[model samples]
Target: MPIITVTNHVGPTYALEPRAPTAASATLFRNFIQWNVVNAVDGYVVQHIQRNEKYWVQRHFPRHQTYQAVSVDDYWECWRVTVAAGVTTITPARDLINDKFTVVTVMDAPGADGTVGRFPDKTGTRGRWKLRGLVYFVADPGLVIADWPAGGAPSAGLLHSRLLPPIQGNGLARNRQGRLGGVLFRREFAGSWDWTTEDQRIAPRADDGVGAPPLVTYRDPVVSARNFPALAGFRSRNIRTADEAAGGWLPIARRPAHG
Candidate 1:
């Protein structure tokens, strides 16, 4: 399985206007100074990227004679972690903030005990950070529907049977708003579903779209059973929580807190 690695680029722009009466000062104030800073910060820090970037700008470029205002922008680069050998090495890369930083090596194979390794890296003398590998178990649609009986009919001694199809698709694992935010995976269906009494029928009609259920998962359950006459044995599963419906992601490494 290939893991996707994301590199966050934080660029800070310092707007300047001359407060001095010198030609050099006027020239320096005419244009803004921008720096391309990159951080391998994990999902946690990336979640507050804007705030972090503002803090960086404030700390690095304080109020000066020529300083007017400061702004920051974030960009991302993603690549698949692939290695022909058992391990792959990432050489030292330079950014404006950190002169030169080295990315940790990634292993292609799992440990002898069949467990993935946690490779940690420390940049600067401030704090220590660790990178943990993540693997997503995508459900097979065929395998999921295979056990489901044809025609949505309940087996012997069974009152009702509902088919829940696998919602994971080949798209990026994005949110319902279609924003990746800090996530690097593919998109998925994050829509809500309304399971009514009609959906709970013992034998759903062939034209009810029950045979080929919708490709949805982690959907919010809106049960309107009270509106319709309820069956004695028909019971609906508990509604999924927000966190349960919204999947999670682990970043490469979190930014160390400033001392």
Candidate 2:
């Protein structure tokens, strides 16, 4: 679990143009200075991320938060955290909600202290700050539907199942194409699913494009229902969330299997 922490300072607010000779000049200078301040803050953020590329990847999942903003005043401040590494997903939660996302555009550099610095290129803006929370790696398993053996009988050698991506809409499913849209399972033969030798790939795409992967696994015939070595179940990030529900999660059928 990699925790990427970001900080921002909230110092005293002062007009960027300290020595504005006239009201018009002061307003013009303020505008110019405001642009520079924005650039400075934005630049610092970009550089900080670029500097720490070793720890975080270059593609970010962005999360933004505004700290303070005074109505009728030039006091709008906010911070954004961007995850660099490509955490590709079948369907991201933000997408389901029609939220906006920004593709990482900068591989930034850290400031003087090797950490993300606060914004506003102004004096006295030093210590007052906020912490932008951590962005962890997420590989969610929205929902899964598998076929088991009849009552009192262990699953036979062959097993079949369907994997649903995080659900966004009533009928929107993030089904992939060819190899990308599939699932994996670990199978055990000694009456229990063996996680060690689990490399089975279940591709869930058919020529017609409206079918779950017809997965097949082999188990011993002598295996009884009590000692039946079922293929290990999948654990997904989308489980127990509305995303799983959107993925067609069923309480009785698609519930995560307990160890």
Candidate 3:
């Protein structure tokens, strides 16, 4: 198998740098975000969009091992636009834990920053940028992880870099007990937050200010709800606020989060 470096294998919490708005565009450079800042990613909400000249900021720094009993570390990724000055951008979150899942974050430029001198002005210097993505090392993988697999089925955040395993697609590798393996109840970030100008114009200044709250933040793959029993039915601490009767609800999941 030709092992290619894992392309697009990051989840949210790993954001791209700020982008200048432009005209010759589609998603309209609006906003950006990062996700999966800490381990135990299972307790995170996530997906995203664009319209402006904005700088996306994302950081993942953990205090230390606090889960009492669980893995400790972090995971993240970055994104760059394909069409230099395109307007619209939308990336999906397959699930919570980022096992090499390709994450895509989009943005847009509004008002004056988007046309003429705005962007994608084929004839201008501000049209296309080789939007670059660089991974910032956060966790000390060597000290924590004993040994992850070289190849097999893909977990929420496991990446093969270039090694393809026997298992294909997103599901458990084995069938245990009465249901699928201990991985399911997956959720993808199908959420989005959108905004449009009354004049439908890109802002002219760097600080033209018109920021919209993210439609859906953090895009990652998830275990399917259809087979959640495997991951849920077992003994596990519930997210403190998820609001489930101890369980059985999404936002219903609350972390050890406290007031």
* Best-matching candidate per lDDT: 3
**Per-residue lDDT tens digits of candidate 2, residues 15-128?**
222333533221101101111111111111100000010011111112321122100100001112232353312111232221111111111212222232222211111111
Top candidate (TM-score): 3
Candidate 3: list runs displaced more than 4 Å: 1-158, 161-185, 198-259
Model 1 residue 220 CA deviation (Å) reads: 57
Ranking by lDDT: 3, 1, 2
For residue 125, give model 3's deviation from the true position in Å. Answer: 24
lDDT (CA) for every model shown? 0.20, 0.19, 0.21
Model 3: how far residue 16 lies from native, Å:
12
lDDT of 3 by residue, 130-229 (tens): 1212232111111111122322111122322111211212221222211111221222221221221122223334443444222222322221112212
Error of 1 at 202 (Å): 91
Question: What does each candidate score in C-alpha RMSD?
Answer: 28.7, 30.6, 21.5
TM-score per candidate, chains pooled: 0.17, 0.13, 0.18
